[model samples]
Structure formats: structure tokens, C-alpha cells
Target: MRDQVTSSDRVNYGAVIALVAISFMLLRKWIAGGVCKSRACLDGKTVVITGANTGIGMETAKDMARRGARVVMACRDLTRAENAAEYIRRSTGNGNVVIRHLNLASLYSVQEFVKEFIATEERLDILINNAGKIEFDDLFFDKRPYSPLLSYKQSKLANVLFSRELARRMKGTGVSSYCLHPGVIRTELIRHILVRFPVLKIILSLPCILLMKTPWQGAQTSIYCAVTEGLESKSGCYFSDCAEKDPAPEGKDDEVARRLWEESAGLVGLNPRR
Candidate 1:
């Protein structure tokens, strides 16, 4: 027996479809976060991006390349880096993309990269330290068991402190510093976590896509901070979603930031006293 196609039933179906579409649109808009509305060009600028071979770093590099900036991709994996650089060059039609080796885990590598860059490159307009790992520094972890997640959080806080102190120190030097939260993008970071616990791959599959930002979306604030004018006045402030946002109370502790800077400089054999 066939059910009659009543006008009320058709209207109900249309209303349901329209409601679902509108809900999806709202969810997408909310998840997209703040976009970099600034259409500033970076012609004649030289930008260096760490971890530019993947995720938000690569996306940032591509945007700079498209803006006619000479982008140097500093990445740990030379092979992957070359591939990323090529992709950037081809997609951007800007052949100024270059690749260099940079292993943040190794101080020696950092020193070497800096030396080589200073020797080869004439000027550095922007230095984006976009690479980070699930690494250490407790404040190195209150004598607790070493957990990667805790280590990563500590590292991020350390970055905020470093950026704040750097901005204070670099004032009047024609340089600016900024730190940001990229809003939990679905990048290779998730793959690493899933590798350790494969079950999470299944558990997180739905939410990862539904809730996480794409690499392009995550890179928006980085691009904004790098190229947006008038942001110089707000340098040192923490940013998220392409706008200035206050960090937590601990992050704003100038005394702690300065102390951490001194300790970090000592560890890295740098003279922050300069």
C-alpha cells in the first residue's frame, strides 16, 4: 500500500531540511573562528617560518608566498620540507620559497640554522616560530611523572612568557613579537596521539572533523599577526582568532616571564643580558 503524498507532509519535510541546512551553516561559521581580514601585501619582505612543511606552518608559508614574500621554510625533515617548498612555489607561482633544516629539539641545529641564515639572507622581516612539539620544561614538571600532554602545555606557557619578555626587550628596535592560540586544528599532531593510542583514532574521528579547525583556519591569526598594520602598538599581547586576547593570570606575570627568560637563556647558552 502506498502512502498518500499530503501537502502537510511535504511542508514538514521542507521545513526539516531547511532547519538542518541552517544549523549546519551556523556550526560551520562558529567553527571557522576569526579570519584575517587584512589584505596586506608582503612584497619585498623576507619571512622565515619554522615547521613550514606541515599544518598551520605550511599554510602560513603559502600565504606569505602568495603575498610575494621570500619565505624560508625551516623544518626538521629536509625531504618533507623540499616537498612543501615545491608545493608552495607551484601553488603560489612565487618561486621565492626556500627550504632549510631546523631541528628545534637540538640546540646545535638552532645555532647552525641561525648562523647560516645570517650569512646567506640579507634581511629578516619576520621570524615566525611556528614549530612546537610535545616537549618539556616543568617550570621542567613539579617532580611529576613525565607526561607528553603536560610537557606540551608547559612549553606553550613558556612561549607566551618568552614572547612577552621579548617584546619588552625588543621595544624601539623596529621589531615586534606576538604569541597566539591556534584553536586546536586537525593537524599531524592528532596523528601522533593516535599512534600511541590507536583506539583514539576511532573515538575522535567524528569530533575531530566536526570541532577542529583546518590548517588554513588555524593559520589565520599567524598571518594576521605577521602582516597586519597597527598591530605593532599591541605587540607582546597574546592573540587568538586574529584579535588581541588577554592570557591567563600566570601568563601575564611579568616577574615570572623575566625569570623564565633568564633561565631559558642560560640553558640555551645565550646572553639575554644583552
Candidate 2:
């Protein structure tokens, strides 16, 4: 009995399927953005990652632990950070993961965390301020309608400025700073926003699976900035997808950055000094 479909036709179908799969993978990789290929080991180095319990912060912590770095998981939630640190320890076989409480909303909390770190640790290395939300008083908002999008953009600009100033001041001191724009990720933050209007944004959420990066993918640029060598000279440069990018003109204003630094230091009770 001869089959309706010939063997050559079957091979053609298989070839088409294979091509589709490969194309899909390539598209995904492109959408996922650049990956950190630097195999620079972090043995004996210390990495402090804020919000290390969730999203890209967690992924970055796992990478640091895997690379033999001492991972300090700074989080507001102790239980969640403990769970994440335990998981990283088990998975990466690195027991040096520790957790410290850091509530960015409160300056006192940050000071306490720093005091503890300084008292215990001998070396302070990479600091990844991955996630944080400082409570803004009404004055900060100026009684205007709160817009998350606007606030987010403002915060990003602030990050770039802070990094730029930090690099400028820390020049010749062997210290460096970096700021990055992690590609859109399907993290808890995004999920919360979309989950609020699930039915309304069903179409939007569906496309995110292919269009956005996972936490692991989003963390690549952060890991790259932290571990890649020879980036000290590139510090203060804005990065996206693991490569240097030019920030907005406002971000490039040296005087503005310096002023922001001084004002921020005053807010934090740090005396502005060279």
C-alpha cells in the first residue's frame, strides 16, 4: 500500500520545521539582547546585590555565587532573601552567600547595613543597586498626580547621573561605577502591573513572552558590568544590552551630575567633600 505522502515530502516537512525552530531561537536570542561572555573569575571578590531575592537581582546573585564570589544579598525581606540565598548556595555549591537587611526607603536602615558590612568585611567590591524604591514625601511629588512611568524614567536618569559622578570622583582610585538599562523583563514588577488589568492587557501580556527577556536574560548586562575586566575606563558610560550607550543630553551634563551628587549627599547626611 503506497502512502499518500511520499518520503521526499516528509523530509521537506521536517526541513521546514527545523528551519522554523532555528529561526525562532535566533529571534529569541536577538530579543534577549547581549550576553556576558566574560569568564573572569571572581574568586575572593565580594558582590553586594540589592533586591537579591527576586528578578534579575536573584539571577545576578546566582551568577556571582557560581563565579566563586562572596554574594551579599541585601533585601528588605529577610525570608525571601534567605530562601534565595539558600537556593544559590545549593545550586552553585557556594556557601558564602549571606543576607543583610537593607531598606532603601529609610536612610537609617542603609546606614546600619553599611556599618555591619564595614565591621565584618575586609574588602568591598562590586555593588549592584539592582532594585530599590525610596519613599518620596509629598514635596517630592509636588502634589501632582503620581505617574509610575514618569517616576521610572526619572529614576533611570538619576542612576546614569549618579554613576557618571561616582566614576568621575572615583577616578584614579581603582573604583568604578556603571549604570545599565536591562531589557524589558517578565519580572514580578511587570507582572504586578499587567496582572492588575489582565483581561484588558491580555494581548499585551501574550506578546511579552517572545518580546521581553527573562530575569536571567535581563541580568546579563549587570553581570557583564560587574565582572568584565577593563571596563573601569568605561565607567560612567550608560550601557544597554551589555554595550556602552550614549545617554540623554541631560545625563551628560557634568554640572548637573555634580549638583545632584551634592544634594543627594546632603539628603543622606553625608558631608559633600572631594
Candidate 3:
């Protein structure tokens, strides 16, 4: 039998579909907001955020601090971290801000940062992996024309890999580790992509700008993962927009995660018990 739909039926179906879509979007946003609004959940917690000098990381640091959490802004540049922390202190009126140096690409730097963090504090409540970079051209925009691009992907992968390894090591230490993606908010990070492909960048960025969350919105997930009640059980999970995310295929490789851990341990000279 041939299935047929009347005009009124079609219209009603379309309306239903549109309503469902709108409801889903609004529901997601509301849940995201609620996760961050819990007052006592974050109070007195210590959170360390990488790349907190700017963009979503900075916003997360500020938001968490406002909720009475001690925030540590970890960045490679000491000056920048301190400057960001000062801004947070002034804005939130919470002075429990500390600046620690952390360079994600360099394992030695991560080790030093972790050592300092562990030495100065007896307990760590949260560690947020928010640092990343995007490089557009290798030998100038036109000189190297069209080669395979891998840098940005590599950095993102590293963020997840590091979080997994760190979570493993911190298993019994009462510290929860999480990796977060801030939903590609407008920031200096996108400048590299924009500069390389100016026209395409604008075209691509348009949809993201329209639908993408603001830096404050982007910080929602990290804040949620950092403070939510059942989060300790979700350690090493990748999160975006306050939802648990499935890391890329490579990110799910337990062996690779272990290798990265061993490699990092070697770099930091932390001997693992075989």
C-alpha cells in the first residue's frame, strides 16, 4: 500500500519535529547551566586549570573562584598566568588564586608543574586539561602550500592522553582528573586557522559563531566536571558542553594511554612499579 500524507498532516509533523529539536537544545543548555550553579559543590575545592590565561579556561577559573573554589591558573608563561590570576582575584574578590607554570607539549614541564603542585598542596580536588594550540602554516602561508596538517590534532590528542594517564596515577589519591573541550569558542586559538584560510575561515566560523557557546558557555562543562557530585567516578572522561564525550578512536587505546603514561613517567623520572 502506498503511504500518503495530507497537507495538514505534513504541517503537524513538521511542527512536532521543530518543537522536539528546540526542546532538546534548550534542555541541554539548562542542564549545563544547572551543573555549574550548585553552590556548595564547588566551595572550598581546589581546581588547577591549564591555559587559564585566556579564553574559556580563564572564564572557568573566574567562575569557579566566584563559587568559593581555590583556583590555580597553570600556564607556560609565568607572567601571563599571574596577570590572569590577578584579574580573577580582583573580579571575584577571592584571593585564593595561585599561578603555576605548565607547558603541555613538554613532558618535563608538566612534571615540574605537578611536582610543585603536589609539594605545595596535600590534596588536589580537580585538574582540568584546557590548554591547546592551533598552528596554521609551517613555512609561511603560501610557501608550504598544501601539506598534511597534524599539529592541532596532535595537541588535542595529547590533552586526552595526558588526562587518562594522570587519572591512572592519581587513582587512589582522591584527586579527580578530566579533559574538556570548550566547544570551539571564538578566541585567539582560531586566529591561526583564520589567517591561513581567510575566506574559508569566515565561512566555517559563521556557523560555529551562531551555534557555538560563548567563552562563559564553553566553560560550563569543565566547571560541571570539576564540581558535580558523581564526577569522581567519571575520572579520565572527556567532556564537552557538560556531557561525557567519547574520545577519538586513538584516545580509547588503553595500550597507547599506558605507553604515554610510561613515556611521561620516564620524562618526569617517576619510576613505575613493574
Candidate 4:
């Protein structure tokens, strides 16, 4: 019995060691960092990033500021935005970083932000629609009970549509718009879900967490979209991992893009222009 127990213990230890090794390899691959190699300077460029207070948005803002771009962090929380702006300014030594209040959930807020931006800023060089949520059943047109998951999906779809319409409108203009998937980033965006389910939090804390990307790593594609030259003609396309990728069928539908733009304009109390 003692011999058998010893053999079992050895087996368990070997399994644990193997698991650790595999987890390390997975983590190395997961965090294989990618950065925009373009040395293009944004000396006179203006970048407005929504949700720039945290996660990939903050990292993107930092990168832009490092390249001498004026970054405007549009966030709902003034205090947090200010804190992030201070951090970016200190880190990048870019004094042009500013914070503006924006709440994507409210059309009034969106309109107000647009009005203020147009009034104060002379040029809008890049618009990065980086903020998204994962709510259940929150479809824009759905009258059913509020589903946070659906709401999140609707918001993402809205980003793509907005970019598409904006690109069409800015065809001749120098302003460019980009929509990107920042990857499965490790951020507080999932805190609400984890708070409700302790088990999930534990699982995510395990070696499997290696699959997630840090905020800085997740910002690579956005940086690529913003400062990379020769991409002026590729506006409105979706990107991931610093490369363009095809979006879902719904996202690629021109009619849907037009309709969503009209609906969004109505929601924001703006007259829709083709």
C-alpha cells in the first residue's frame, strides 16, 4: 500500500509539472507582442479615442502621444480620465493629451461630444472607436427585455457601421476612421461577469489565462490602423492583430451600414447625410 501511494504521488507531481510547462509555452505564444513599426510622426494629427481611460484605449493613446499626436481621451468618468491623461502625459512627456467626457450609451452625450470637438478642434485626423461592452440582449432595435449580451453585440456592430459611414462621408477629406478588434484583452471589462461568478474568476486566474493579451499587447492593431501610412484607402475595414480582417456578413452589408447610420443619426438628433 505504501509503494502504491508513492507511485500515485509521483504521477500527480509529473502531471502538475507537465501542466506548468504547457501553460508557460502557451503564455509565451499568447503574449508575443506586436507593435506598429511605422516611424511616421503625427506631429499635427489629432486622435480621439473613446474609452481611453483604461485597457487597450489607454495604451493606444499613449502610443499616439509618443508619436507627437494630440490625443483626446473621451470617457464617461472625468476623474478616471484625468488620472489616465496624467499618467500618459508623464509617461510620454506629451503635454498635448487632453480628456473629454463621453458616454456612448447616451445619444445626447455623443452629439454633445461631436459638437464640442468640432467647435474646439480644427482638424480630426483619426477616430478610433475602441470602446465596446458585452451586455446581455441589448440589441438596438429589440423591444424584448434588456439582455446585456445582445446589447454588447449591438454596440460592436454599431462601431463597424459608424466607421463605414464615416469613411464614405470622408472620402475626399483627410480624416480617417478605423474599427478594430483588440483581441481578448485582460481588463476590467469582464469584472462584472467575474464578480457574479466566483468559479469563473478562479478558472480565469488559472494557466488558461495565458490566452488573454495584456492591454498594451491588445493595442497593437489600433496603433497600426492609426499611424500606418498607405492605409488611407482602407478606411472602414475591420482589423485584428495589426492586420485587416473581413468582418461578419452583417457588418459587411452596405444597406445595413446605411440604415444603421440613419438610425444613429436620428438617435443623436442629427440629420442623416448620404
RMSD of each: 3.9, 4.2, 8.0, 5.3
What C-alpha lDDT values do all the predictions have?
A: 0.78, 0.77, 0.69, 0.75
lDDT of 2 by residue, 1-274 (tens): 2464687788899999999999989989898999999998888777788888999999999999999988889998999898999999999999999998877975446656765654332322332222223234442557778878667766666677777887888777677778888888878876667778878577877777877899999999898888887887786777889898777677787887787777777777776674
Per-candidate TM vs. native? 0.87, 0.83, 0.67, 0.78
Give the per-residue lDDT digits (tens) of candidate 1, residues 1-274: 1355677788899999999999988987888899998888878877888878999999999999999988889888999999999999999999999887766965446657765654332322232222233233445556668777767767777778778887888787666778888887888975776898878888888888887899999899888888887778777888888888878776787887788777777777877685
Order of all candidates by lDDT, from best down to worst? 1, 2, 4, 3
Which lDDT value does model 4 have at 33? 52
Who wins the TM-score comparison?
Answer: 1
| Clashes per candidate (backbone, < 3 Å) | 2, 0, 0, 11
lDDT (tens digit, per residue) of candidate 4 on 96-176 = 999877767766676577656554323333333333432223335455676776567777777777787777777776666
Query: Any idea what lDDT model 4 has?
Result: 0.75
Which portions of model 3 show Cα errors greater than 4 Å? 1-35, 41-45, 78-83, 100-105, 118-148, 193-208, 267-274
Model 1: how large is the Cα RMSD against the reference? 3.9
